[model samples]
Target chain A: MSTAERTAVTATRTRGLRRILRPRARLWLGTLAAALILFVVAPAALSGYQFGLLAQFLCYAMVAVGIGLAWGQGGMLTLGQGLFFGIGGYAMAMHLQLDDAGPGGVPAFMSLYGSGTVPAWWEPFRDPWITIGTIILLPAALAALLGYAIFARRVRGAYFAILSQALVAAFAILLIGQQASTGGSTGLSNFRGFFGYSLADPLNQRLLFFLAAGTLIGMVLLVRLLMRSRYGELLVATRDQEMRVRFLGYNPALVKTVAFVVSSVFAAVGGALFVPIAGIISPSDVAVVPSIMFVAGVAIGGRATLLGPVLGSLALSWVGAQLQDNYPSVWSYFQGALFVLVLGFLPQGFATLGGVLRRRKGDSR
Target chain B: MTTTRPLALEVTGLRVEFDGFVAVRDVDLTVPAGELRFLIGPNGAGKTTVIDALTGLVRGTGTARFDGHELLGRPVHRLVRAGIGRTFQTASVFEGHTVLQNLDIAAGLHRRPTTLLRRRRGVPEEVLRALDTVGLDDLADRPAGELAHGQKQWLEIGMLLVQDARLLLLDEPVAGMSGEERAATGELLRRISRDRTVVVVEHDMEFLRNYADTVTVMHRGSILAEGGVDEVQSDPRVIEVYLGAPLDAPTATATARATGRETR
Candidate 1:
């Protein structure tokens, strides 16, 4: 063969190989479908309660992906996704409670917190669509306001991190202090039905699981589309060099704010789905500790890679759940050790393992 | 390719001070469209300072108007948008992008908002035309970081070409180029001057003599002389500055004066 022909052959082979191995949307969707069928449908076939728990874990993974986008890709170091998550959970929880209690009827937690009468603020949640809409809009609006204030003033790095953490801290404190309006320390729980269907029924439980799975899959696709767009390049450029991007005729603050708002919306949606599957809404669920745990999973996966966040979140959550069952008290220490190990030895995360192995193979060849 | 237009750039009473020391003091200059002006001076003579002030990189207490728009206090991107493009002393190409991408970005200047809403299109034909001018079209796919020094210099010029600015500010465009590369760059500048105003700051006297339609000499934060290359070269003050001698006499005359004094 001529030199051109040899080059063409190599190009063809590479193209074919890429087609076979590239992580296309269909491939990922198919994989997710298969996993849903196996973990959710199969478990629903065998045991209903176990399926519900797995769905809850999937919700956590969805929030982890949001953390990855904000902290990992955009370099915002957000330790307050839990606040948005909680907003979503509470929005959905309020709506469910209202649906259960009917108009003017007080929820179980409202009487425990001290009021025999339903609050006016909880009245709007009587509309299921309004409550669901708030789940997506409330957190995004808050993020937009917060991100605008912080990024517009050029506050970034550890300062932004601290500010975000403070938001979550304040949120948890407010939830604990507001006993009359909110449930205070003991959250709104013991839900019975969602839109006239029994949440405890096996079919209803499976349906909730499917919804959570579908939401996660949808969020992943949305993020993938965003990352492949021109805005995505600007986002990455903002992370790498803000000044250069500014000189390149882009407003870095605006770009970062949009990404942060989008990430917050993702977290809210995840938290919204989390309520029905987990069957609880509390200050503890949206506290500072859980917020940090969300970031830890993304860091261990790889911030810049797509699948890294999802798999890392799922694996870490699974391990945490397993260890909690096996050792109970010692699991927290082991989790901390895992983070330190990953940070020290594999700072690039497990996603880069394939690249490392490829380099070794090239050297041998 | 030429028009009898007014000045493309005009600077009046340009003053730049850094930390209480005056770097460029009360300098005045102008370059008409389609004219090639050389800013020639010794080290620390504030030539680069004048260019930086013109490009909005340095704050100067003077009026710099580009096509009648005030340039001072405007940000760098705004200046670029106002039809003034510049090449740095050290090339500042985006290293991650391909050669074509760099040119494409330059071509996209002021035309499209660099947002996700804008679609990425095929490399504009003007980009290839620019590469052809710089003779880098063959390497369009290669990363800019991997180019040779001369190639990078040419690539920077190609970027400026695609920007199609009315005024081009170049700092030492041939600083590190080989002799052949220098000659090609001089030719390139002469050709580009057919349609745009070019203000070049260069220390290479030969390159300036070959390409500059007019040369301005700077000394101690001021314009010392302004004329054609031969006129500025033979100016007594320019000679004194270049030779590092006193303002009055040649070395031979000075030596003879000293001997006569010693004999007396």
Candidate 2:
């Protein structure tokens, strides 16, 4: 055949295949199927301890998705999501402790701190529904307010990043100082039940694992949907060129603020789930170190690509857990080395591998 | 064709300083509705500074009234909302979006409601009409960054057209166009100026000669001459400051002899 005829045939076949496959739908379906299998089927096969670890990793992955949206896409470089995460975790932790203590009983931490009475601020957390709802909404509302104050004045880039980091530092310090109610450096732990269900029971543990897995899948789908919408286009535009987006009549500050808040809420939900699965809440989990770990996973996964952050976080957390268990002395250094290697060699993250393969295929065709 | 209404843009004693260096100094100008005016000068003559000040991109101490609203301290987006649209010297089309999406964003500003539940109509027919006017309707689906230089320039103009601003500020609208593209741009401007006011900053003399009803000349951050194109071209101060000293002896004589004509 002539070159023209061959080209025409190739084009026809490509179009026919595109029509039959519907690339976007296929991707969605494939992702959903994979997540279902990973959450439902894989956990069933693993030991109880392994399932619990997966549950913890899923929570971390949820936070990673939020970081991907805020720092990766919106270019906010937020290093303080841990503050919001801790807020949700502590809120839920307080409620869980109260439920374990029974009516009119003080938490064990309050007794150790000095006062035999629960603080007035901790009163609202007694309601399970309120605590659960606050875990989702409180951090988002606070983020919205903070984002509006900073971004509206056009504070961005490194200055915004430093400000967010400072907030996290202050939060950790505050938690450390509050020995009575907050559990200080050690943090609140040794919970017995959540909403009247015994935490020690194997069934409750499995249920919490499923909840975390379901929550992770749901959060990923929500982000995917948002990123595919027109608002997502506006968000990317705002990130690329705020001046141009402004000239196009969009208030870039407002758009960025909304995205930041939504991301914060996602992180908060992850943190809330994290406490129940891990059976503990501590300053170590919501400190600057963990915040950096959150960003490292996103960078290693490819910040712009969907599913990269989730998978990257899961893989990195799994490795971290394993190395710490097997070689406790060098695990931290090893994780740091991994970040350095990824940054030095694969700055676009592992997602670019797929793009390269596709390009090669196109060239051959 | 003068109306009782004042000009769309009236600037008097406009002065803009950047770190104590005056970019636009004591310049006065006016552009009437339905008229195409050009501000022409050599490089560093403050043409773009004037555009920036008018668009509120730069702060200026001047009396700039557009449809009777003060523009000196207002923000750029607010200026656009007040019926003043502008295109940048370097084309400002969104690189990641399609040409149609860029225009839709420009037009979408006027269509936003108080709530998010409202359905936003995609690229109205008027936007398509604007693209057709600039001969870029077929390239609507293409990413804007992939378009040719001249086509991107036209697309920027199309964005301004779809904005439907009462007063349009176009900075170097035909800066990188070919001969055909430049002529097409001139035609497009002429067609657009029938229902709106236009203030264009251009360095292309031929383009100014073809389209400008009035030409404002600037030198050293101030208006040196304002009149018809021929009047500004013949102004001695403008020629001396902008066109440079007359080519003496060998150069002039050589050009005259080559063309078989007397030196001016």
Candidate 3:
């Protein structure tokens, strides 16, 4: 074939490929396009401070995605996700604090508040890799253990909710009590660097924002894949009728445990990233209020849909930040009213709001 | 179908007590493979409890075995994996799923190590076949929650059919079915009995009379009589318990006639 003819054939082939990328492929492509705009384009457009705020919202969005999976799909009502998130944040914060401290040195907080010596528990976190590993494993292990014990005994519904909330309360108390190791109620902050990238640099901060956005996109994609699988069907089935699932030869407890563990790991990863992005880890962050706020964001977004929780959380948190800045006194009240309105009117969340409107229109017709 | 067939389910001295109120008491029952046996009694007679004990849905102090496997202490899932499938008194289905998806979940139940990442797109032939059997193949894409009560019952039974369960314990399978649906269900149960052990706990006397090969009558949590449907109906003790009159009373024949004409 001649060069001109070959070039024409190649162009047609590319056009064919583009045409084939319709519907499902188009959905993924759209998501990718949106992600690029958000993580890359938006970062480029926004100031450093605005980008950092966006990154912080992304961290909460990460937690909301996990809540959507567990509470929305699995029917777990996991109000204590902050427990996992806080644990992950603390793990990362401790490692950064240790890194800021020179070798053969304890974290500055330990010297100031604690005895001059480093606690035995804090020693392992000095290794950045260990800290990262702990952030993933610890919360996952706790969720798995708790899920097994509760689900095996068939403790569910409101009881399970209460038990998980109690665990968060207890975790917050434990962290607060361990002043020397945990830096007490004020939590850990004032990080000098992240993996040797200086936090003092605006470029590095922007990079951190990109990293968070990238992780959120990856986690959302992973959850989307899971929701389309047989396991996802089984999880929903278990939620609807556990005894029926057992009669079909599935251990519902095991299915629920898997969902709980996956959600916890997501929260943990979110928490770990939160440390560098938010630059703080404290008892107040991991308490019941934050845990419930995580649920509220999911509820506002629509619990069952893939992107609802992420978008809902980001929007709510951003609005909250704005509210705090402009109307600090009434912002919380506004937040409560918005949540109430969403619950009363759009129980399926904003994700299904379009469907609800369409249905009402259809009824009129 | 034959006396020579090995027993598929065997129970001895089976008893279930809930908070010291004896629900099932010292029941001794044996069912051979490939037989359609019906357990019938009035309300609160522990007919369902015996099934609960056999399927490990409720703890019972007795020996219950299915195909030589001890089932008394085993969990519900193990019993299911060992080829015992049960339907609830109130039809319990994955209501949010389409008819095909419900069957798919059932058909895929025995698959080992359900993968975490892969999407399950294909429906198993067994699920398709079961849907066809229950005549729900035409409506396979409709959500089960939207199905009529009778259809939901059929879907659940179809779920058991997809599992290829060796032993089926159906609790009130025709509770809310219309007469036509009940007749179809009777035909389906007869078909299922051709190659499997079926123990149906029902209050529908006419259905048992038309379809059951053997009938076990329960009264006050124990077997009152056990035999062919005609024999159990004629058994003097069964007549008294069912008719609320002595077997030799003047009202006995009238009561028998009334019961014979009753459908449910």
Candidate 4:
């Protein structure tokens, strides 16, 4: 054969061979690559400060996963994920502060800022097991109740978004108003340890980062299963044709409630982890702004895709940090411009890049 | 088309009102098992309201029984579980999903919650069979939104087929169809009614004359007449209501009244 023809024949053979791996195999391979970067490359490459910042972004990414499910798939448009995040964050923070206080003593901030006596509500969090359990269950229960109420009334779209935003605002203001129990506006912070591990130790900090990374990956896998499962189809179906789904013998409200609760639980778990990693739990984190930021991250990532929220969160955070360091005065405007560009030009976000490239190629041909 | 053991539906004193204005008033309807019944009426006739009551989409005062289960006062999904289903004027398929996925979701009425979590296994025989029944097997993998108008309607009927919905209430299934599409839809409905009971709310007079086994004419939210095609068509009252002409007056005078002036 001529050399050009021979090379073309070999290329065709290799392409056919590679197609044998299939989508399922490709997914597993992609996941392995991500895990390697997160667990090994990230730790080996970055300074401790930058590494900690990445860990913080992962927590936000976790929140984005739940937002993707509830808002992206279920069409909920929840603007108050920070409320659930705060619930979990405060739950963990209370326990950490109580543990540091030793036995029945009050946290230093509480004694300094408010009444010396610990409130009755703060007592249950003193037990680490109860704290952990509450961290998981409280947000889910609240979400279930709140989701049922709103969805049952068929309140959605901008109204649901507005209500969720109002809720986070109220929650933040409530924390600020309560001086004695919640440390007023300053909120909860300065944990000496995490479940008996010294935060001062570099080894423990790395371990916490790993925990956050593993949790984020686990959540992505879980939501993957949900999206592939019948429940996932039903969730998307519910989003599109809620009334029709009702006539299909599925309770649309119940279907929606499950998505809402699951998403809220994810946010809560992210919040719970945030306490140990970021060493703070304040109203500032749980207010309306951070919750909206969670949404922006997911939207920029391609909300419906499995890993879009994670990648989106990481990318947005990295860029935001770089801009803040360099531009300082106009960093916020750059971020706003980024949101407009992504949401306007690429409504489905970065996940559609492959499809766009393929389409362009097809058009050329 | 696969044959299903259709359920019978009976309603008595079924009344529906929107804020003190009665849309459907004390109406009585009985559709026997495996009968293809057509409900025809004018603009304000409330033929669709009766369906709304039956499907639990609206609150009605009286009882609507499907087979042995009570339909009224129950949630819509519960009524669906009780073997009742309906299609809408506007297409309601999950437009993003493939044709096969749409049917699979409908056929999964009996699936357990835990089973819903796992990825769907191999396609069930029922789903594959429904695909062929609706003649959408070729487009099984195509997104539902991509289907043409008639094809979308057929896919909807296919969904009800696998849902195993015994009593099917179709609203304007051929609203925007060409003659050819109408004939195909008519043929499909005929095949469906061989086993399953069907109530179709329609406005196309030609489609009705061709396909209706029994027709119930409704006027002003009440049953005006009920019988075979020719019987209702010949009734003077029916002709008068449809043409808006006075039966007792002379033809010339009736024409004059139409223009609001005396012809004589």
- Give each model's whole-structure lDDT: 0.79, 0.81, 0.86, 0.87
Clashes of each: 0, 0, 0, 0
Residue A337 miss distance in model 4 (angstroms): 1.3
**lDDT for position B203 in model 2:** 77
Q: Give the DockQ-based CAPRI class for model 3.
A: medium
lDDT per residue for candidate 4 within A1-365, as digits (tens), equals 98545655655565575688886886788789879999999999999999999999989899999998988889988889999999999999999999999999899987787778898999999899999999999999999999999898888889999999999999999999997888778889899989999998999999999999999989988888899899999999999999988889988888999999999999999999998999998999999989998998888988888878878888998899888988899988988998999989789887665555545556777
Candidate 4 local lDDT, B1-264, one digit each (tens): 245466778888988989999898878888888788999887778998888888988899888888889888998888888778899988889999999889888877877778888888889888898888889999999999999999999999998888888899999899999999999999999988888889999887778889999898887878888888767766666666777433223532443354444223
Kindly report which residue stretches of model 4 are placed more than 4 angstroms away from their true locations once superposed.
Answer: A1-20, A360-365, B1-5, B244-264
Pairing residues by index, what is the TM-score of model 3? 0.93
Tens digit of per-residue lDDT, candidate 1, span B1-264 = 123243478889999999999999989998877899999887889999998887767899889887879988887667777777777777767666678866765665545554464545576777878989889979999988899888888888887777666788889989888999999999998888888889999888768768899999998999999998777776767765766433223542444444447658
Off by over 4 Å in 3: A1-23, B1-7, B244-264
Task: Judge candidate 2 at residue B152 and give its lDDT.
Answer: 89
Ranking by DockQ: 4, 3, 2, 1
Better of 2 and 4 by lDDT: 4
lDDT (tens digit, per residue) of candidate 3 on A1-365: 98545655655565577688874886678678968888769977887777788888889889999999998899999889989999899999989988899677788888898778987888898898899889998988988998999999999988888999999999999999998889889999999899999998888888888888888988888888778888888889988998899889888999999999999999999999998888899999889999999999999999999888988998899899888999999998999999999989999898877666556656777
> Best candidate, lDDT-wise?
4
DockQ score for model 3: 0.66
User: lDDT of model 2 at residue A4?
Assistant: 45
Output the lDDT of residue B143, model 4. 96
Q: What's the DockQ for every one of the candidates? A: 0.29, 0.38, 0.66, 0.77
Error of 3 at A259 (Å): 0.8
